[model samples]
Target: MLQAGMHAFILALGLILPLGVQNLFVFNQGAAQHRFRQALPAVITASICDTILIGLAVLGVSVFLLKIVWIKTIFLLAGVCFLLYMGYVMWKSKPAVSEDEERIFSPKKQIVFAMSVSLLNPHAIMDTVGVIGTSSMLYSDMEKYVFTAVCMVVSWIWFTALAIIGKITGMADKSGRLLGMLNKLSAFVMWGMAILMLLSLR
Candidate 1:
Protein backbone atom coordinates (compact mmCIF):
# COMPACT_ATOMS: atom_id res chain seq x y z
CA MET A 1 0.00 0.00 0.00
CA LEU A 2 2.77 2.41 0.87
CA GLN A 3 4.57 1.75 -2.38
CA ALA A 4 1.36 2.13 -4.33
CA GLY A 5 0.65 5.42 -2.59
CA MET A 6 4.11 6.72 -3.33
CA HIS A 7 3.90 5.71 -6.98
CA ALA A 8 0.55 7.41 -7.32
CA PHE A 9 1.89 10.53 -5.60
CA ILE A 10 4.88 10.89 -7.87
CA LEU A 11 2.92 10.11 -11.02
CA ALA A 12 0.15 12.51 -10.12
CA LEU A 13 2.59 15.26 -9.25
CA GLY A 14 4.52 14.77 -12.46
CA LEU A 15 1.39 15.03 -14.55
CA ILE A 16 0.09 18.12 -12.74
CA LEU A 17 3.30 20.10 -12.39
CA PRO A 18 3.32 21.37 -15.96
CA LEU A 19 1.77 24.71 -16.85
CA GLY A 20 -1.61 24.19 -18.49
CA VAL A 21 -5.00 25.78 -18.80
CA GLN A 22 -6.24 24.16 -15.61
CA ASN A 23 -3.21 25.23 -13.64
CA LEU A 24 -3.23 28.73 -15.06
CA PHE A 25 -6.91 29.20 -14.37
CA VAL A 26 -6.53 28.18 -10.76
CA PHE A 27 -3.37 30.18 -10.39
CA ASN A 28 -4.93 33.28 -11.87
CA GLN A 29 -8.00 32.89 -9.69
CA GLY A 30 -5.88 32.57 -6.61
CA ALA A 31 -4.01 35.72 -7.54
CA ALA A 32 -7.10 37.65 -8.51
CA GLN A 33 -9.09 36.81 -5.44
CA HIS A 34 -8.51 39.06 -2.49
CA ARG A 35 -7.91 36.23 -0.02
CA PHE A 36 -6.90 32.57 0.02
CA ARG A 37 -10.39 31.46 1.07
CA GLN A 38 -11.96 33.45 -1.73
CA ALA A 39 -10.43 31.13 -4.31
CA LEU A 40 -12.10 28.05 -2.80
CA PRO A 41 -14.71 27.80 -5.52
CA ALA A 42 -12.12 27.44 -8.26
CA VAL A 43 -9.98 25.18 -6.10
CA ILE A 44 -12.84 22.96 -5.06
CA THR A 45 -14.31 22.75 -8.56
CA ALA A 46 -11.04 21.77 -10.16
CA SER A 47 -10.37 19.22 -7.44
CA ILE A 48 -13.79 17.71 -7.84
CA CYS A 49 -13.37 17.47 -11.61
CA ASP A 50 -10.05 15.71 -11.20
CA THR A 51 -11.57 13.34 -8.65
CA ILE A 52 -14.29 12.36 -11.07
CA LEU A 53 -11.86 11.80 -13.93
CA ILE A 54 -9.48 9.72 -11.82
CA GLY A 55 -12.29 7.61 -10.43
CA LEU A 56 -13.62 6.90 -13.90
CA ALA A 57 -10.18 6.15 -15.25
CA VAL A 58 -9.32 3.72 -12.48
CA LEU A 59 -12.69 2.05 -12.22
CA GLY A 60 -13.77 2.09 -15.84
CA VAL A 61 -10.60 1.94 -17.88
CA SER A 62 -8.48 -0.30 -15.64
CA VAL A 63 -11.11 -2.97 -15.26
CA PHE A 64 -11.80 -3.22 -18.98
CA LEU A 65 -8.12 -3.36 -19.84
CA LEU A 66 -7.58 -6.09 -17.25
CA LYS A 67 -9.92 -8.50 -19.03
CA ILE A 68 -8.13 -8.48 -22.39
CA VAL A 69 -4.55 -9.66 -22.69
CA TRP A 70 -3.98 -8.62 -26.30
CA ILE A 71 -5.52 -5.25 -25.64
CA LYS A 72 -3.36 -4.88 -22.59
CA THR A 73 -0.25 -5.30 -24.70
CA ILE A 74 -1.49 -2.76 -27.19
CA PHE A 75 -2.49 -0.34 -24.44
CA LEU A 76 0.86 -0.63 -22.75
CA LEU A 77 2.74 -0.03 -25.96
CA ALA A 78 0.52 2.87 -26.91
CA GLY A 79 0.89 4.38 -23.45
CA VAL A 80 4.66 4.18 -23.67
CA CYS A 81 4.59 5.94 -27.02
CA PHE A 82 2.29 8.60 -25.59
CA LEU A 83 4.46 9.33 -22.58
CA LEU A 84 7.45 9.80 -24.80
CA TYR A 85 5.57 12.12 -27.10
CA MET A 86 4.20 14.03 -24.16
CA GLY A 87 7.70 14.42 -22.76
CA TYR A 88 8.91 15.92 -26.00
CA VAL A 89 5.95 18.26 -26.15
CA MET A 90 6.60 19.39 -22.63
CA TRP A 91 10.27 19.90 -23.33
CA LYS A 92 9.47 22.23 -26.24
CA SER A 93 6.44 23.93 -24.72
CA LYS A 94 6.58 27.54 -23.65
CA PRO A 95 4.71 28.53 -20.53
CA ALA A 96 1.87 30.95 -21.06
CA VAL A 97 2.25 34.36 -19.54
CA SER A 98 -1.00 36.16 -18.95
CA GLU A 99 -2.00 39.11 -16.83
CA ASP A 100 -4.65 38.47 -14.24
CA GLU A 101 -8.15 39.44 -15.31
CA GLU A 102 -9.11 42.95 -14.39
CA ARG A 103 -12.32 42.13 -12.56
CA ILE A 104 -12.92 39.84 -9.64
CA PHE A 105 -15.00 36.81 -10.57
CA SER A 106 -17.89 35.74 -8.47
CA PRO A 107 -17.99 32.22 -7.08
CA LYS A 108 -20.50 31.17 -9.77
CA LYS A 109 -18.33 32.31 -12.69
CA GLN A 110 -15.37 30.67 -11.07
CA ILE A 111 -17.24 27.39 -10.78
CA VAL A 112 -18.39 27.54 -14.40
CA PHE A 113 -14.97 28.44 -15.74
CA ALA A 114 -13.30 25.86 -13.59
CA MET A 115 -15.63 23.19 -14.90
CA SER A 116 -15.01 24.26 -18.47
CA VAL A 117 -11.25 24.22 -18.13
CA SER A 118 -11.17 21.00 -16.17
CA LEU A 119 -13.61 18.98 -18.28
CA LEU A 120 -13.42 20.62 -21.65
CA ASN A 121 -9.68 20.18 -22.04
CA PRO A 122 -8.66 17.07 -24.00
CA HIS A 123 -5.06 16.90 -22.83
CA ALA A 124 -6.05 16.90 -19.20
CA ILE A 125 -8.52 14.12 -19.87
CA MET A 126 -5.83 12.15 -21.66
CA ASP A 127 -3.48 12.45 -18.71
CA THR A 128 -6.13 11.15 -16.35
CA VAL A 129 -7.42 8.38 -18.53
CA GLY A 130 -4.43 7.42 -20.64
CA VAL A 131 -1.64 7.70 -18.08
CA ILE A 132 -3.17 7.37 -14.64
CA GLY A 133 -5.87 4.90 -15.61
CA THR A 134 -3.57 2.56 -17.55
CA SER A 135 -0.92 2.72 -14.83
CA SER A 136 -3.40 1.58 -12.18
CA MET A 137 -3.23 -1.88 -13.80
CA LEU A 138 -0.04 -2.59 -11.83
CA TYR A 139 -1.88 -3.48 -8.61
CA SER A 140 -4.90 -5.26 -7.36
CA ASP A 141 -7.21 -5.30 -4.28
CA MET A 142 -5.91 -3.07 -1.47
CA GLU A 143 -2.99 -1.55 -3.32
CA LYS A 144 -5.26 -0.42 -6.09
CA TYR A 145 -7.54 1.22 -3.56
CA VAL A 146 -4.61 3.00 -1.98
CA PHE A 147 -3.38 4.03 -5.40
CA THR A 148 -6.71 5.58 -6.28
CA ALA A 149 -7.10 7.28 -2.93
CA VAL A 150 -3.62 8.73 -3.04
CA CYS A 151 -4.19 10.08 -6.53
CA MET A 152 -7.33 11.87 -5.42
CA VAL A 153 -5.64 13.23 -2.33
CA VAL A 154 -2.80 14.57 -4.44
CA SER A 155 -5.22 16.43 -6.67
CA TRP A 156 -6.91 18.14 -3.75
CA ILE A 157 -3.65 19.10 -2.10
CA TRP A 158 -2.11 20.27 -5.37
CA PHE A 159 -5.00 22.52 -6.36
CA THR A 160 -4.95 24.11 -2.93
CA ALA A 161 -1.21 24.58 -3.12
CA LEU A 162 -1.39 26.09 -6.61
CA ALA A 163 -3.82 28.63 -5.31
CA ILE A 164 -1.53 29.46 -2.43
CA ILE A 165 1.44 29.78 -4.73
CA GLY A 166 -0.54 31.99 -7.06
CA LYS A 167 -1.42 34.32 -4.23
CA ILE A 168 2.22 34.59 -3.28
CA THR A 169 3.71 34.87 -6.76
CA GLY A 170 1.04 37.16 -8.22
CA MET A 171 0.24 34.77 -11.15
CA ALA A 172 2.70 35.95 -13.79
CA ASP A 173 6.05 34.28 -14.38
CA LYS A 174 7.69 37.25 -16.09
CA SER A 175 11.00 35.56 -16.74
CA GLY A 176 9.39 32.15 -17.51
CA ARG A 177 12.38 30.57 -15.78
CA LEU A 178 10.34 28.90 -13.05
CA LEU A 179 7.83 27.35 -15.45
CA GLY A 180 10.58 26.43 -17.91
CA MET A 181 12.35 24.47 -15.21
CA LEU A 182 9.09 22.80 -14.25
CA ASN A 183 8.47 21.76 -17.86
CA LYS A 184 11.92 20.25 -18.13
CA LEU A 185 11.55 18.38 -14.86
CA SER A 186 8.10 17.08 -15.78
CA ALA A 187 9.39 15.91 -19.16
CA PHE A 188 12.17 13.92 -17.53
CA VAL A 189 9.78 12.33 -15.08
CA MET A 190 7.48 11.32 -17.91
CA TRP A 191 10.39 9.86 -19.82
CA GLY A 192 11.46 7.86 -16.79
CA MET A 193 7.95 6.63 -16.23
CA ALA A 194 7.78 5.58 -19.85
CA ILE A 195 10.92 3.53 -19.41
CA LEU A 196 9.61 1.86 -16.26
CA MET A 197 6.31 1.01 -17.91
CA LEU A 198 8.05 -0.37 -20.95
CA LEU A 199 10.11 -2.64 -18.72
CA SER A 200 6.94 -4.15 -17.29
CA LEU A 201 6.12 -5.61 -20.70
CA ARG A 202 9.04 -7.99 -20.37
Candidate 2:
Protein backbone atom coordinates (compact mmCIF):
# COMPACT_ATOMS: atom_id res chain seq x y z
CA MET A 1 0.00 0.00 0.00
CA LEU A 2 2.80 2.39 0.81
CA GLN A 3 4.48 1.59 -2.46
CA ALA A 4 1.26 2.12 -4.37
CA GLY A 5 0.68 5.44 -2.65
CA MET A 6 4.21 6.59 -3.43
CA HIS A 7 3.84 5.63 -7.06
CA ALA A 8 0.53 7.40 -7.34
CA PHE A 9 1.85 10.55 -5.69
CA ILE A 10 4.95 10.73 -7.83
CA LEU A 11 3.05 10.04 -11.02
CA ALA A 12 0.37 12.61 -10.27
CA LEU A 13 2.95 15.23 -9.32
CA GLY A 14 4.86 14.71 -12.53
CA LEU A 15 1.73 14.79 -14.67
CA ILE A 16 0.43 18.00 -13.08
CA LEU A 17 3.77 19.83 -12.95
CA PRO A 18 3.39 21.04 -16.50
CA LEU A 19 2.16 24.61 -17.18
CA GLY A 20 -1.16 23.52 -18.58
CA VAL A 21 -4.45 25.37 -19.07
CA GLN A 22 -5.93 24.28 -15.74
CA ASN A 23 -2.90 25.36 -13.73
CA LEU A 24 -2.67 28.66 -15.59
CA PHE A 25 -6.33 29.43 -14.95
CA VAL A 26 -6.01 28.60 -11.26
CA PHE A 27 -2.91 30.74 -10.90
CA ASN A 28 -4.55 33.61 -12.78
CA GLN A 29 -7.63 33.52 -10.59
CA GLY A 30 -5.49 33.54 -7.48
CA ALA A 31 -3.42 36.47 -8.68
CA ALA A 32 -6.43 38.38 -9.96
CA GLN A 33 -8.64 38.10 -6.88
CA HIS A 34 -8.42 40.76 -4.19
CA ARG A 35 -8.04 38.05 -1.54
CA PHE A 36 -6.55 34.59 -1.74
CA ARG A 37 -9.77 33.16 -0.27
CA GLN A 38 -11.72 34.42 -3.27
CA ALA A 39 -9.87 31.93 -5.43
CA LEU A 40 -10.94 28.90 -3.40
CA PRO A 41 -13.98 28.15 -5.49
CA ALA A 42 -11.92 27.93 -8.66
CA VAL A 43 -9.31 25.80 -6.98
CA ILE A 44 -11.86 23.45 -5.45
CA THR A 45 -13.83 23.17 -8.66
CA ALA A 46 -10.73 22.31 -10.63
CA SER A 47 -9.66 19.69 -8.09
CA ILE A 48 -13.10 18.14 -8.14
CA CYS A 49 -13.05 17.91 -11.92
CA ASP A 50 -9.66 16.23 -11.73
CA THR A 51 -10.97 13.83 -9.09
CA ILE A 52 -13.81 12.83 -11.36
CA LEU A 53 -11.47 12.30 -14.29
CA ILE A 54 -9.06 10.27 -12.21
CA GLY A 55 -11.91 8.19 -10.84
CA LEU A 56 -13.29 7.52 -14.29
CA ALA A 57 -9.84 6.61 -15.59
CA VAL A 58 -9.30 4.14 -12.77
CA LEU A 59 -12.62 2.52 -13.62
CA GLY A 60 -11.35 1.62 -17.10
CA VAL A 61 -13.39 4.30 -18.84
CA SER A 62 -10.28 5.18 -20.82
CA VAL A 63 -10.55 1.85 -22.62
CA PHE A 64 -13.94 2.86 -23.85
CA LEU A 65 -12.58 6.29 -24.86
CA LEU A 66 -9.85 4.66 -26.90
CA LYS A 67 -12.41 2.65 -28.84
CA ILE A 68 -14.26 5.79 -29.86
CA VAL A 69 -12.01 7.74 -32.19
CA TRP A 70 -14.69 10.27 -33.07
CA ILE A 71 -15.26 11.17 -29.46
CA LYS A 72 -11.58 11.87 -28.96
CA THR A 73 -11.48 13.95 -32.12
CA ILE A 74 -14.48 15.98 -31.08
CA PHE A 75 -13.01 16.63 -27.64
CA LEU A 76 -9.69 17.60 -29.13
CA LEU A 77 -11.28 20.05 -31.51
CA ALA A 78 -13.36 21.63 -28.79
CA GLY A 79 -10.31 21.91 -26.54
CA VAL A 80 -8.33 23.64 -29.24
CA CYS A 81 -11.05 26.17 -29.89
CA PHE A 82 -11.61 26.86 -26.24
CA LEU A 83 -7.91 27.33 -25.56
CA LEU A 84 -7.56 29.77 -28.43
CA TYR A 85 -10.51 31.84 -27.24
CA MET A 86 -9.26 31.85 -23.67
CA GLY A 87 -5.82 32.87 -24.82
CA TYR A 88 -7.22 35.84 -26.67
CA VAL A 89 -9.27 36.85 -23.68
CA MET A 90 -6.30 36.69 -21.36
CA TRP A 91 -4.12 38.59 -23.74
CA LYS A 92 -6.62 41.40 -23.97
CA SER A 93 -7.35 41.58 -20.26
CA LYS A 94 -6.16 44.55 -18.26
CA PRO A 95 -4.90 44.08 -14.75
CA ALA A 96 -6.89 45.66 -11.91
CA VAL A 97 -4.77 47.56 -9.40
CA SER A 98 -7.46 48.16 -6.76
CA GLU A 99 -10.18 46.12 -5.14
CA ASP A 100 -12.84 48.36 -6.65
CA GLU A 101 -11.33 47.95 -10.10
CA GLU A 102 -10.53 44.27 -9.82
CA ARG A 103 -12.70 42.26 -12.14
CA ILE A 104 -12.70 39.03 -10.25
CA PHE A 105 -14.88 36.33 -11.66
CA SER A 106 -18.00 35.46 -9.70
CA PRO A 107 -18.06 32.07 -7.96
CA LYS A 108 -20.38 30.65 -10.59
CA LYS A 109 -18.16 31.90 -13.41
CA GLN A 110 -15.09 30.56 -11.67
CA ILE A 111 -16.64 27.16 -11.17
CA VAL A 112 -17.83 26.97 -14.76
CA PHE A 113 -14.48 28.04 -16.20
CA ALA A 114 -12.59 25.75 -13.86
CA MET A 115 -14.74 22.81 -14.87
CA SER A 116 -14.31 23.60 -18.54
CA VAL A 117 -10.55 23.88 -18.28
CA SER A 118 -10.22 20.73 -16.21
CA LEU A 119 -12.82 18.54 -17.88
CA LEU A 120 -12.78 19.73 -21.48
CA ASN A 121 -9.01 19.56 -21.86
CA PRO A 122 -8.16 16.57 -24.01
CA HIS A 123 -4.53 16.48 -22.95
CA ALA A 124 -5.58 16.32 -19.31
CA ILE A 125 -8.13 13.63 -20.07
CA MET A 126 -5.52 11.63 -21.96
CA ASP A 127 -2.99 11.97 -19.16
CA THR A 128 -5.46 10.74 -16.56
CA VAL A 129 -6.77 7.95 -18.73
CA GLY A 130 -3.52 6.93 -20.39
CA VAL A 131 -1.05 7.35 -17.53
CA ILE A 132 -3.02 7.15 -14.29
CA GLY A 133 -5.42 4.53 -15.56
CA THR A 134 -2.68 2.34 -16.97
CA SER A 135 -0.65 2.65 -13.79
CA SER A 136 -3.59 1.47 -11.67
CA MET A 137 -3.55 -1.92 -13.34
CA LEU A 138 -0.68 -3.01 -11.10
CA TYR A 139 -2.58 -2.42 -7.86
CA SER A 140 -5.65 -4.05 -6.29
CA ASP A 141 -8.23 -3.55 -3.56
CA MET A 142 -6.83 -1.46 -0.69
CA GLU A 143 -3.68 -0.60 -2.57
CA LYS A 144 -5.71 0.72 -5.46
CA TYR A 145 -7.82 2.82 -3.16
CA VAL A 146 -4.70 4.15 -1.44
CA PHE A 147 -3.20 5.00 -4.78
CA THR A 148 -6.30 6.86 -5.89
CA ALA A 149 -6.57 8.68 -2.59
CA VAL A 150 -2.97 9.81 -2.74
CA CYS A 151 -3.35 11.11 -6.28
CA MET A 152 -6.49 13.05 -5.38
CA VAL A 153 -4.84 14.46 -2.27
CA VAL A 154 -1.87 15.59 -4.30
CA SER A 155 -4.18 17.43 -6.71
CA TRP A 156 -5.88 19.28 -3.89
CA ILE A 157 -2.61 20.15 -2.16
CA TRP A 158 -0.93 21.32 -5.34
CA PHE A 159 -3.78 23.62 -6.34
CA THR A 160 -4.02 25.14 -2.89
CA ALA A 161 -0.29 25.76 -2.83
CA LEU A 162 -0.37 27.23 -6.32
CA ALA A 163 -3.15 29.66 -5.33
CA ILE A 164 -1.25 30.71 -2.24
CA ILE A 165 1.86 31.32 -4.27
CA GLY A 166 -0.08 33.49 -6.68
CA LYS A 167 -1.62 35.43 -3.83
CA ILE A 168 1.77 36.04 -2.26
CA THR A 169 3.22 37.22 -5.50
CA GLY A 170 0.30 39.53 -6.09
CA MET A 171 0.68 41.04 -2.65
CA ALA A 172 4.33 41.74 -3.29
CA ASP A 173 3.76 43.30 -6.70
CA LYS A 174 1.18 45.98 -6.14
CA SER A 175 1.96 47.63 -9.45
CA GLY A 176 0.04 44.98 -11.40
CA ARG A 177 2.59 45.10 -14.20
CA LEU A 178 3.88 41.67 -13.27
CA LEU A 179 0.36 40.30 -13.44
CA GLY A 180 -0.10 41.77 -16.89
CA MET A 181 3.08 40.09 -18.08
CA LEU A 182 1.94 36.82 -16.58
CA ASN A 183 -1.34 37.10 -18.43
CA LYS A 184 0.48 37.53 -21.71
CA LEU A 185 2.76 34.63 -20.94
CA SER A 186 -0.26 32.53 -20.05
CA ALA A 187 -1.87 33.50 -23.31
CA PHE A 188 1.20 32.39 -25.21
CA VAL A 189 1.27 29.09 -23.37
CA MET A 190 -2.41 28.43 -24.10
CA TRP A 191 -2.04 29.26 -27.78
CA GLY A 192 0.96 26.99 -28.01
CA MET A 193 -0.94 24.14 -26.43
CA ALA A 194 -3.85 24.73 -28.78
CA ILE A 195 -1.53 24.63 -31.77
CA LEU A 196 0.02 21.41 -30.59
CA MET A 197 -3.39 19.81 -30.22
CA LEU A 198 -4.43 21.08 -33.63
CA LEU A 199 -1.37 19.49 -35.22
CA SER A 200 -2.02 16.21 -33.46
CA LEU A 201 -5.49 16.09 -35.00
CA ARG A 202 -3.94 15.56 -38.40
lDDT of 1 by residue, 83-177 (tens): 67656765775544444344466799789767866765444665688888988989999999999999999999999999999777644556656
List where candidate 1 sits over 4 angstroms from the true fold. 61-102, 171-202
Clashing pairs in 1: none
Q: Model 1, residue 131: displacement in angstroms?
A: 0.9
State, as a TM-score between 0 and 1, how close model 1 is to the true structure: 0.65
Candidate 2 per-residue lDDT over residues 1-202, each given as its tens digit: 9899999999999999988889988988888888888999999999999888899999998669856989889888888888888888889876667875546777887898788788777877888999999999999999999999999999999999999998888788899999999889989988998998899889
Q: Each candidate's root-mean-square deviation in Å? A: 8.8, 1.3
Q: After superposing candidate 2, which stretches have Cα over 4 Å from the reference?
A: none
Top candidate (TM-score): 2
Highest lDDT among the candidates is held by which one?
2
